[model samples]
Target chain A: MFVDLLFNLRAQGLVVGVGEWTGFLDAVGRGLATDLDGMYHLGRALLCRSESDFDGFDLAFAKTFQGMEIADDLREKLEEWLRDAKERTEGERVPHEFESMEDLLEAFRDRLEKQKERHDGGNHWVGTGGTSPFGNSGRAANGIRVGGSAGGRSAVATAMERRWEGYRGDRTLDLRELKVVLRLLRSLAHDGPMELDLPGTIDATCHNAGDIELVEKRERRNRLKLVLLMDAGGSMAPHAERVEKLFSAASQMKDTFKSFEAYSFHNCVYQWLYKDIEQLDRVATSEILAKLTPQHRIILVGDASMAPYELFSSYSWPSTTTDAGIDWLRRIKQRSPAAIWLNPDPQRFWQHPTVSAIGRIFPMFDLSVQGLKDGIKKLRVPH
Target chain B: MAEFAQFSGTDRYIADEALMASVNAALVLERPLLVKGEPGTGKTLLAHAVAETLGRPLYSWHVKSTTKAEEGLYTYDVVQRLNDSRFGDADVSNIRNYIKYGPVGLAFDSDEPVVLLIDEVDKADIEFPNDLLRELDEMAFTVRELEETVRAKQRPLVIITSNAEKELPDAFLRRCVFHFIDFPDRERMERIVHVHLPTLGPDLMKAALDRFFAFRKVAGLRKPPSTSELVDWLTVLVASGLDPASITEGDPFLGVLFKGEADLAAAVDKRRGRKSW
Candidate 1:
């Protein structure tokens, strides 16, 4: 029986070997695992090595023991929600029962507090598969869906959301146009004679070889420091490929700037900005502000389509004392007056309340070549 | 199995209920526990803490971007062998002496169960995790030079950590139990702070936490001070004999709390505004 299970796991792309099979059998024979749960623990211990494989093992385990098919439950639910959403609104603005934002938030908070069990269909409480003004699935004029894709309705807030990965990767940047725009904000300065200009020295030496002259060259460097803050996570996932292209292009322009630094945030510039995508050692935004001087040109890349609360609320889940996203943007702008917000969200959505709110503080532009040119022009003009 | 229960709640480490449960689950199942979290959140330390508490020898493999999966298993010194065959007096026929076992190999060959930590597995190339899948699952690998297969006498308790920089392949992820170590709450932070600075007075501790939380609350600070940073800041405070109340913007020791120049300027700006009032 264990061998069959191991075979099944192998068939499902799990790397189960002879040693793990023997170990599982040994544990079973020794009565280490008598029940299904015990066997699961034993099988998992012997056959798996990394967390990346847990989902696969879970599926294999379920299929072998419970005879249940593993399916994309979340995707299916999202598709169903989309269908329901499409049926509800046929090019008509569905009127909401709640009159104000405060009423909606109040009702949502109350239901969230009382919600103990997962409710599928209800007018109250946050849960999945419900018409309640909370949770995903079912229709509600204005509710905070806990999970699933954005149903393009009155979802005031989304809790524990995965970053969106919906943007097409084929959008290529015109490097010539990019370079022209990027050159406008150059702040070059001569910082004395720093290094040997070998090529220049060689050329000059050969020309004046008859005199055997020693020529000294002073080095002038681009004094401009760039802090590129990228939006990462659920909402930025779709724009990842394009953003990556832009990031690489910017980084490759080694001669354009004296120094270039990049950091990533989720929906907004929060307390922490990660230098790496792994969410490893993040430099505090305050620290970033501290490190960068007023002369530094800051470019923020993000699609500001997050729930307004994420921008306005002081407290978000997982963070007890998070300041509003706009406050962070203001502080960044305050320190680096030359900062520009490069929005990947289309020009049409620039009118979004959250987008407009952020735009009020920092001049917002599209992520396209034209937008880049416009943003550089704005930065060049003094406040 | 009962003895394993005693390894919980070591002075060096304080795991929450959920994390402890995951650890216990990994232990009972005899699978590698893959821990994911932000930097300085104790993903690496958890392995050390577990090894210390369990009294098992810990083997660590610090993975880098250039690290290949084969380096974790064993390395065959082909150059040395070739040199010996051509010029040296020593016999090159016996290749066992030249075969150096890596952390994973050593753990597998051990007589007893040991703890193996693959630190920052995400730093490696995309193929590294996938390459590890077979050896990790089987707990055995074949060394072609020796023409011998090395099998585990005892299954090593493996712990893998990822900073979430890159997503591990689904095939690789499915093989292990997973846990994410979130940032500690204030109460948990108090416990963590106390662990690092036992001699800290209540007044100083309170003052430090207040300042730390205040820095964290600043909206635009890129990277908030983590638990380790907090500890380092407190250590600096206790060492410098600096008064907690006098610790304001422009204080030389402000470098301990904030790493960025802009952050310091912003803090100083805020302080100046307050002073003007």
Candidate 2:
């Protein structure tokens, strides 16, 4: 019976197994989960391993148990059955004194609206006289269930709410996750000025029949230099949060890189790149290109989305000469062939003219956990 | 079969209905409960609560980066025996004297059911959990030197916690019941605070919660104040005998709540209307 639920969970991208399903069944059979609400919690506890799967679990649960609400519609069905029985018993005559139940309800509501003060003995107003149809404890037949006794039985309603949507993996890149991803860029090598190699000296002395020999080797250090070129302001504003998380994660890892530098650009890199996100402090793009070596791992963070003219047009606001924004981008990529563009925008939106053009220039990946991992893998390759 | 004790919750630990159900399910299934949550959400305290509620002995194994799964089962002190034999300090004939049981080994050796807390399991190497998969699943391990298989007298109620430093292996995760402790909502938070501070006045409680929640909303806080931090802050406030009316903006106990300098600045600045609140 729960095989459909298992398939549904798998369809929603949760890695559930037959073992987990059997365990869940065993738990339910042992009376661990007594009701539908209890089953929801029990299923989540048994099936899901991380908070990232919670949203998917909720979606799958809601889909599998859609319209299985028993408590809510019970009253309506019971009333319908009662009405049918009364009609058969009365033999083709109206059960209530009014033309229909709707008319009776309408008249009751109309009286309810007009009646102001309480009347103890009257049958007109919806008061406690045992005659009015609207009030509780009344003798009137086919009265509405007043003041509520029915409670909702739908467990799927809670699942449909999707409260854990914020915890979805693709939605946000938390600081810790970003740091973990960026830690992959660390490449430790022994390349600094030579220091005394004690082990090497001992091995050499032992091999040379006890004659003392000195050996010097370069010190081991993190030799990777990181250059971050980020798109800032204007259209890139929506992505500033994700880009900031990436930037902070990279910059905070003081031991991960030999040298780290970040510069911002608006939409496209023109003749200059701003030192700060405010775009106030500017450094010439040619100077940045001249300074960067191929050994440096350049990570470009941006949505890579802009008007076609912004990349191709020669006279696009910031640049006045014949050189367009695309020329500057190509120049940077040429200087550092190790560069990769990280688009905060989803992959589906990459078909945009400017995003694709930039994507073509540099291997692009979305700014997410998996994307960062893949990007680091690309960045790790020696040029 | 002996009936396993059910865990409703302890007086100090304010577990909601969902948490209770998850705990009960894990208990009934006799599987390790894998708890993932934000820092200060009482994931580690859960094992303690269960132990206290069930009146069982608690054994904890705090995992570190260099921690090995083998060490959790048994650590044979060969060096000690060698030193003793060399110095002629004690008898060295018995090899069993050198064999010391680790936390897991001790739990397996216990006469009664115990609650074994594997705190911060993700701190170890990626292969760490996989290495102990068989031992955890079967509740048994072999001491190769002794050539004896040590099995559990009673299946220990295992609770593993992760701050999610890294992704746990799928095979290891599949054998466990998982629960992610979400940040408590307003009502739950209130109950939690009252549980921790029974004597706290309602006025002060409202004021502290208001300030604490407001401070959390300030943007760019690298490490936001969580439930434990709130409890600590409230404890400090109550200890200082500060006026409830004085617990408005720019409370002097901001240092207790915010650990980072930038977070403190952001919170204080938000109150001053320098940034969007």
Candidate 3:
């Protein structure tokens, strides 16, 4: 019965395997869940592994059990009212007529459709700022409010709210997480002071009939020099925070890298790269190119979105720079072969003219956690 | 099936319904419960609470950046044996004496069920979790040098906590029950704080919570103070004999709330009603 729910979870990009599925089924069969609420909590606890998957789990749940809760909730409320009515004394209670179950359901469905139509009409439903009877906090007699007042909406509607969307991992990089992923960009080589090799000392002692024989090995240290050229100003302003996080994380890794340098430029790299984002201090691009070697890895951060003339024209990005932006890019790439481009723009929008042009120059990835992971993997290999 | 003790939370820990369900599920399923959340959100404290409520002995293994997976199982003390033979008056004939068991091994070797807390597992290297997959799955490990396998007499309940310094492997994550403890809402936060400080005045509690939530909403805070910090700050407030109304005038004891210099500056700027930092 839950096989469709499993498929739906997979369709929503959750990593739900047979092991998790069986465990979920096991929990269910053990009588842990007796109602919709219990089952919802059980499925999430057993199947979802991270906060990122919670949003997807809620989606899959709402899809599988869409309208089931409406009837369940109505029955529960009716039963509750019936019990309340039973508690009242015979003299205090007034005689009431009830509609047939079918007619009651028919009226409920019609009212639901009318509520949705009013929602679509605007200014009369949940989406509008004005007071509407079918929405929350609206003042209308005998009007049913939806959401925010708990037990008033169906379970499916609550699940569809997707409250855990902020915790999704696909968004922009967090600061500490950025530092963690950037730690993998190191190329470790053993070249420092020796430390005692405990395992080898034990092996030598055991082989020599419990005789003491000390063994020592050199410690390993990261030996890669990293250069970060980030884009600033103009269209890059939207992505300034993300790029700054990347730059700050990389620059702060003093112990992880042999040397690290960061320079900023507007749009694309021209003849000059600024020492800071303010663009007050500038240095010729050729001087940096001359100082760099083939071994040094370069990471270029930018949105790579601009007019077509910005890359090919000499004075488009700025009137002062003499060389074309594309020429300076090729010179840097030629000088340091191990370089990659990190675009803050989503991959779907990479069809832009300038982003595509830069894509041919350097392998590009998004400026997200997963994208940075992929970029770090590519950076580790000697390109 | 054996009857397992369920954790309904202790007097100190205020776990929500979902968290309770997760702990119970993990207990019945006999899988490790991997609890993750922001720092100071009681990720590590959950293990202590579980151990106390279940009436089981607790074993803790604090992970560092250089910690290896093998250290959790058994460590061969070759140097000690060599020293005993060379300069010390001790028997070196039996290798078993030198095979000291780590936290996991100690938990497995215990006669009764125990709670093993691997605190901050993400502080170790990326491959740390994958290395223990086999031993964690089977609850057994073979001491290769001794040519003997150590199996659990009673499967110990394992609880792992991570601050998400790094992403854990998918295979390792799939074997455990995961839960993220969100920052408690205002009502829940008041209850949590009240649990820590019962004698706190209502007016002071109201003023402090208002200031705390307002400070948390200020833009560009590098690190926000959590529940534990709030409790500490309020304790200081009561001890200093400060008036509840004066709490709104300026941030007293700001150091107790904000640990980061950048966050402190931003908070101060916001309080002063500055347009820019």
Candidate 4:
């Protein structure tokens, strides 16, 4: 059974080699996994090294076990819904009847208990289609979707969420506009002691007609330090291209500062911030704060579009240190008074509850040339 | 293949059941284990713990942004060979004398199943992982300069860690087992703390944990205190002889707890009114 699965995975362009096959057999022989889920996890652990291969591995695994031959059939149905959803905005409604998520959740819980069998297209009960407050493929703008691709972005939550596409660091960005704005944040100080001026030495040497001459003088280095905190994953996926451009531009400003640090976070700043894309090691927020002085400028980049609960609720993220994202933002603001937030979400969507909530704490600008100019100008002002 | 019993006694690591299962699978399968996690969550430590448990010699390759995949196999010293030929030195015609074994090459040439750690692999270029695919899969590589193929006498237990700085190719990922190390919970964190500081007093430990958890609960912090930070704070607390009861008070030691200027200000602001300082 496992061999057949491995063969199928290889056929599907997974590149399962002889070594991996032998290892899979060894795992099964050793009884590392007893059940199907365990086997799935074991297979995934042994087979998939990167997150990009996860989607392919899932399809191959499902096809081999569930005996589903038509892989494209489900995707085609999903694609059809997506196409229809994009074209038809008539069925789009937020169901303003419920005042709060709590009330909707309470009603949803009752319907779930009353539901006895699989339901499809009805006014009530947890199933596909209709104006029901639960399940996928329905006109319920606030429904909780289960077991389908997110055709429409109306769901409060999802069961089978799509994998987050990792950010590509090598992508090229037109930094001309960004560099112009970033230059505003530059603050050069001549007070600090400097080393030998190489360019000055060469000029002086040439002036002396090939005579051995050297110039030793202090050169002004940019005293300003900029800390860029970027948001990644999920909602920020749509704005990746723009964010990459910003990242490329910001990274190029290394020569503009005595010290520059960039870190990536998901949704909100929490216990850990990734220093790099691979997210192998993280420098604690506390450590970052300690390392940077109050004089340093902090720039936050994100769409700031998530459930309000993620910002204010105590149980937003499991096993995290923070009770509320707002508190963290406030803390950051208090430390670095010059901190500014750059929202990739359009100015129209800045009125979003979460975005507005974040805006209240930090001065925000859109992720554009003008927005970046305004943000840099704001950073120049003394706190 | 080694039995499951051989890989036992990994209790010092404090890994969860799922993580342990992944490690076991990787060991049994003889495939490389690719571990990903946020920093300071013990991703690299897993490799060390596994190697220690298996009683295997560990070979580490710390990759930087400029690191090339060829450096892990073998490097031909063309300049040195040319210099030797120019100097009329002995064995100038022998190409094997100029070939130096890199970490991967060393691992393949090992007589036993050594543990190979490729730390922070995402630091390298996009093509780095793909370049290692054939060698990793076949456990061998041909040195074109020497005109000889070197095969592994014993398959090394490869461990690759990524910071998620870059996305690796799907083909490279499919060749290894994957595991993600989540941030340890309070209970697990307590165990980890005890492991590091066994001599910590009960009262101080309780107070410290309380303060740590409370500080972590504060929002909008760009970087929250991690497990290692907590340990570092405790080390400082023990060294300073500060009272744990006064931890909530505006103590200067808050610097150890919150590293960022903003985080420190927030911590100070949260405790007592702004004018109290």
Which candidate comes out best when scored by DockQ?
3
Per-residue lDDT, model 1, residue B201, is: 84
Error of 3 at B269 (Å): 3.8
Which stretches of model 4 miss by more than 4 angstroms?
A: A1-30, A40-383, B1-11, B82-90, B250-277
Candidate 3 Cα misplacement greater than 4 A, ranges: A71-142, A146-158, A191-214, A290-294, A313-316, A319-323, A331-338, A381-383, B1-5
lDDT of 3 by residue, B1-277 (tens): 1243277788898887678778888888888999989889999889999999999999999999999999999998877887788798887889898999999999999999999999999999989999999999999999998999999999998999999888899899999988888899999998898889989999999999999999889777777889889999999999999999889887799999999988888888878988424
Best by TM-score: 3
Comparing 1 and 3 on lDDT, the stronger one = 3
Per-candidate Cα RMSD to the true structure, in Å, reads 19.3, 9.3, 4.6, 18.6
TM score of chain A per candidate: 0.49, 0.64, 0.77, 0.49
| Tens-digit per-residue lDDT, A317-348, candidate 2 | 46576778899889988888888999888889
Candidate 4 structure quality by residue, lDDT tens digits, A1-383 = 67678877776566677766777777877788665555666776777654445555665676565422112233334336534443443455544767654455566656655554546788787667887866768887665564454443221121023232231111212355466457667787775676777756765654443455787777667888889999987888888878877888778878878788899887888767788855566867667766766788999999988888888876334345645777777878888889899988768899899999999888998887657767877899944
Return the TM-score for each candidate structure: 0.48, 0.76, 0.86, 0.51
DockQ of each: 0.07, 0.44, 0.52, 0.20
Superposed by TM-score, candidate 4 places the C-alpha of residue B21 at a distance from the truth, in angstroms, of 1.4
Query: Least accurate stretch of 10 residues (summed lDDT) in model 1 chain A?
Result: A159-168
lDDT of candidate 3 over A196-250, digit per residue (tens):
9987887887778776789899888888899999999998888888998898888
